[model samples]
Target chain A: MSEHTTLSDLEAAIDNTFATDAQQASVDVVEPGIVTAVETLSMQQALNRALAEVLEENPKALVLGEDVGLLGGVFRITDGLQKQFGEDRVFDTPLAESGILGMSVGLAMAGYHPIPEVQFDGFAYPAINQIVCQVGRMNYRSRGTMPMPITLRVPSFGGIRAPEHHGESLESLFAHVPGLKVVSPSSPNEAYHLLKHAATRPDPVIFMEPKSRYWQKGPVDTSADGYSPEGSRIVREGKHLTLVAWGAMVARCLQVAELAAEDGIDVEVLDLRWLKPIDAEGLAASVAKTRRAVVVHEAPLTSGLGAEVAALITERCFGTLRAPVERVTGFDVPYPSGDLEDEYVPNIDRILFGIQRVLENRRG
Target chain B: MAEISFPLPDLGEGLIEATVLEWLVAEGEQVERNHPLVEVETTKSAVELPSPQAGKVVKIYGGPGDTIKVGDPLIVFEVPDDTAGIVGTVPKEEAPRRRVRLTAALDDED
Candidate 1:
């Protein structure tokens, strides 16, 4: 294939994988079969289906953001939602992130579960004041009398060659703020369930989507099962090292675990689905078993979400750890251009290096 | 040589069918494992299906623009007995690796 053809072909393959997964996911939700019948779906499609389901079940739920109405969002996460739910329920607002969020807070105050989409992670900076100050603190401010049911969706993380400010992994920033539940789903199954859970909650939630994994496909059981997004889960069981990650990095960790297996090292993978109010107990249990831990993320290392996770692990599993916790993360620099993104983002080699560092420090 | 019928694999979650956009390889053409075989588009994105093993394309299933279901056979590959494990048996590791951007700026190696 020509260079141009190859590039586009690669892009197409990624897109096709997500699309096919979404199609399969629809089957599970709509088809009448055994409750265990699972369907594959891309992360993006799963989120879309979750939004559709939320609007369908909850009449008070409203979805609004720039292009969410006619354009169906930049990534089309809200595609056909307006048509299904009408212009009032799924509509667009001014291109102001702060305004969108501020309005969501007001709507929530009026008893509406407002699910607003902040077009991109970088663009969310404009609305950080509202998110951090009002949306996050409203329930606490009211002394439990009032609850803010706003699920702000921000498509985040690097990779996919997006422009500056488009691929920011700002989950750490939100998780630092008090009273906000921060969630980052890694797969279609988690994305589908976690989004629904976020919408149903009485508190404000920052639903960070790893934009890079929008097209990543996986199996999803849409059988009205009880899957809570409240805590972390050990996705893969191993005894050598514990890999803690969320969003896109979970897949990377799983891949690293596979590579580590080649070297006879058993790696347990933990998906920290909920960033804020992290499952400290679950994380501690996994670390206690493995005795070595490595935190991974697409965000920059300094004060990233990984730092909080590492601190938690160190504090809880201090006596059990065999070595110092290592972190595999993006460099502490502005997200690089598309051409140099691979260099900026963590990959298999970097994660392996982290595992190796922990192993080298293992107590004899 | 045994014939392996390569069906359209699940492209992503919930995808039941896809439309053939283009054929990268032709019937009677030789292909190696992981070679691009066809381009298919679903509702989400365009994807290129790769060959599972080294073989000669014995038959092509659907023409461009034809919609094929998940289990529909897309290609028939004639391969040696040892290579005939299953069609669309591309290893998970063969999938595209995420390029790790060099962190020279972060390193102290001047």
Candidate 2:
């Protein structure tokens, strides 16, 4: 009786410093194996885990690529696939990039959910003909009467110290193509769910696996509970600036966000999973709060998707912008040698520099 | 004579075409199972394709620098009909494999 009477007093004594669930709801799981619950894996391992789970859940899901079946891929993302799924289901393809994409187009037309690997970003150039003209446009051309439920996987971005054209961030090229949905997961968790989502999408999707972040591990809910590619994830909410990025750049932006935190700069981070139909509304809202923004990517600064994002932000939130949008991106020159990739790829300091520029503009 | 045709296998990371860099065996040359048949370079890396069935090479479909797609006829071997003891010896499945399509129910839309 005494304790019951003292309950209100104890409640009143509580600090109430910790935030409650009222702030944000728990994560919603779309599919059972959509996310990894425990130990995080490298981006590559995360993709492999997701593919294994997806193939297990859906017998129709097939993985086709060069060296992916037996050699486990040059990056080893598809290691042991041939043995587990048998040579028939997870075998290697010919060296023709266009043939791979064209065959995938036909496979999707024939009702196959094909996930074809382009091997590398530079190599993906050859497949662009098939992807841009046929694979990307087939479904729209048929006006939904036909769907190319194919996922074109390419490991893109610089910073892995790859030689020559191996590390080019050619996202702009894919983004320019209609009927193709481009996406990149910046971390292991996003990689797991995004790949699953890409595999399941009805239209052809260009899944650019960030080869640079292939080995970085993070939290993943492998229990299959995760978000969809259609949604833009808010990594951090800020009242000062909105930092929008994807794939490897997202990770760099997050680091910059951490640095900004040290300087009392509250910056919101937006991870755009689906690059084609981006979460424009959500991004505008973030910019409206911050009144400033910085768009970043590994692709060249000239016509990268960041340019499109900058345009969209200004169009949607013109009055809200405290300053013009800034972009931190790769240079226009060809991807340099492995030794010079560090300078080519945008990093924490570069992103921070962008934030500083935007903040200064806001002050001015 | 039993005909052993080597239809190109999926090289894994979804390669569709490969360039034949070198032929390890000449037409009419005898080869053993798992012997390196040809060196093919795809988009990612260069690899040596192994002979599935041990026999005499009757024909080579792709020459050096010639590009070929998966499921294309790689080689035609005059395999002996004496024994079908080869484990991985798959009869030429098809000239070009029909696309392996995933059913609609399994198609996961975003």
Candidate 3:
């Protein structure tokens, strides 16, 4: 053998090159759902488009939240909406989370589609009782006689380094409560369509907004069908490791996939947009091919959606997995302050660590 | 004097305090009823508060970045004597008041 083929020669060439394993994997392919030339719009703008479109389409749809009237909401998501629709239709409410949601349940019972913005993730805790007891169970309580067609737009997640309650991933809390449909949009595109879908759905939806990703630009076709909020869209596909995430974490996982490519790991990223009725079949199929799974989210690790997903994966794809399912999530402590949050959140490194752990188990 | 009390409106989602993002009306500025008078930033979104009375803005209670509580006076207005007579008696075009609850701020948690 030539000296150029020596072990040291191979080590010298490979040691300096940092390529991710995902980069080496096959390109993700799926039926391109729908595409419309969408402009670069902020999260608020996309939401406005969706709301405006829905209101125009459905006369029964009403937008309510704190300061949604002439103030147009705190984030201005409802800006100009009242002006266009009139104050009688789009109005503000007394500041009470439970009241906002409870009134919405009442209005929905009266055949109006009440869309209330909880304003912030942590702020929604007070309304948990209304959501769990009333909004969640209203349908079953009515025995199909009434439909609680209400949508709660909750702006959540971290990365802005905001205060404690400002950046919380509380999806698991709502997901655990039956009868509540949870849908989190990872980009502007999803924000527009999913909101439209959620507005029309016959059940109440906990629409989680990744507050930090409110400005991230993506294609939002107000005219296209790809942005269905009711269905989960597979963002990427691979046959080695499945990275299932939602909201802002989906973008984080995509970044992790780029880093993972250098390590020769093929990761399939699934955007679990609708978390309540999770796209279990889609997730199961991906895990089956990869034989490994890593569920990632920003919520605290204890009883987080990751745990639920891991359980679901184990239950559905246990035979296909060569390694036990893994999870990458935040610590169990309260969402740390902005400065300490970086240490608490699950980043690309954490995701890679989870993938490595799962892959290592398979190797052994 | 039209005691234009800009009570702190509910900032929504239990947001008690909001940063005064901007002042749409300055002191002594003539504002029409229902015109925007101030901008406040809460955790949820930024909202432009409408003026409750159409008159000269007498004073602003809070400056930018100050967090005001719900029901706290936000601004005052100098109304014409005719309008002054009906200040608290009649609910003359009462602007919506957002409800604010006493809750521990995020930092207050141990």
Candidate 4:
């Protein structure tokens, strides 16, 4: 030890720790069957099964995060994975979001597909540096020669009634990043397929799983079915007005549509699955048919994802639109704790009112 | 020998009942603590209930698709007389933030 450490002194100490020459091992990753059977699964089970299938199909794919391996994740989305995949493939890292993502960047560069979990949406703040600086830019920095095939899973949105830092709606932040592709699945079937597809992409994908909808059951036709993971889809069709939403809000919009039907309002529910690389064509077509639009989300109003959806609709369907696009979203404030969540999140009544705003608006 | 009944627990806040999806362990079989006993689908999520303690399965009260109330007996086990004590549902005021630990945050199965 020295009173003042010099650069050369530090370099010499690091050099003494290990050999200078690097020994790189070749990785042979094999792709197995994705999925084939049609069955019912809760969103939690579907996400878990999707990760299992991803590991089974791709030998190079690795799952790592805080409590992800040994604890199967706080949400149990990766339950039983450590036992099935062995420690080398599915392992836990310390409670460090930045380190987890930094490790993913290094692993991805070394020819391995890393699927890292951030544990919670609020926890992702620490990893912003690695995500923005390395994961999203490495491929471009290397001129497409080095592609970062990383799918970072984040359990997002509120409704779990957990304490502070447990629930967050972070799609807008991730979507704002230039090089990241964002996708949120509303159902078990979409979760299964989207996760499988997202893992195979060459670019980085921010896979946001709606925490609240993780247990909602739905039929998943595992054998290559209708919906593609790249764009949005009209889950429920109507001709009067369109309700655009993603994640947990999609289900809420569906409920609103059901209630609006009693009042002769034919509301169409469109699940905007992919937040980044926004589906311009799909949004245009859906709103064009209905001639009116209302965007719903759990995120706050100022700079929320709903604003983007409304802007996209306005840009794409301005000529055909009968009324201004409405946004029904959480109030502009920090997301509150469990007791106040019901008031913060957009409920059936809030969405219905947004629908009314659009439906009642006239050219005058 | 002593017989003890384990009631279906309320998996989530305000959940009153759940539909039995399956019984992982059958009656007349030996089981250990933490062994998954049954799967039930509540309004919130589908979760497996683990054995409260090591014992012989004496009886199971509910079948698949059967609705079991939160405090109703779901299973029964026979244990050595000396080891038996109060088994289920600590009053709300006395309960800790967490009591069950076999989950995958569903508690540590350790």
RMSD of each: 16.7, 18.8, 19.6, 16.1
Model 1 error, position A100 (Å): 0.5
Better of 2 and 4 by TM-score: 4
Candidate 4 TM-score, C-alpha based:
0.72
Across A15-49, the per-residue lDDT of candidate 4 in tens digits comes to 43221123122335465545577899988789988
Ranking by TM-score: 4, 1, 3, 2
lDDT of 2 by residue, B1-110 (tens): 44556777878678898999999999989999899999999888899988886788999987899999998899988854323222111112122222212121111110
lDDT of 1: 0.80
lDDT of each: 0.80, 0.75, 0.75, 0.80
TM-scores for chain A, candidates in order?
A: 0.89, 0.87, 0.87, 0.90
Model 2, C-alpha of B83: deviation from truth (Å) = 42
Please report how far candidate 4 places residue B44 from its true position, in Å.
Answer: 44
What lDDT does candidate 2 reach at residue A55? 70
> Can you list each candidate's DockQ?
0.03, 0.02, 0.03, 0.03
Q: In lDDT terms, how accurate is model 2?
A: 0.75
Runs of candidate 3 exceeding 4 Å displacement: A1-36, A225-230, A362-364, B1-110
Candidate 2 chain B, poorest ten consecutive residues by summed lDDT: B101-110
- Candidate 2 similarity to native, TM-score: 0.69
B71 in model 2: Cα distance from truth in Å?
19
For candidate 4 chain A, which ten residues in a row score worst on lDDT? A16-25
Candidate 4, which segments miss by more than 4 Å at Cα? A1-35, A362-364, B1-110
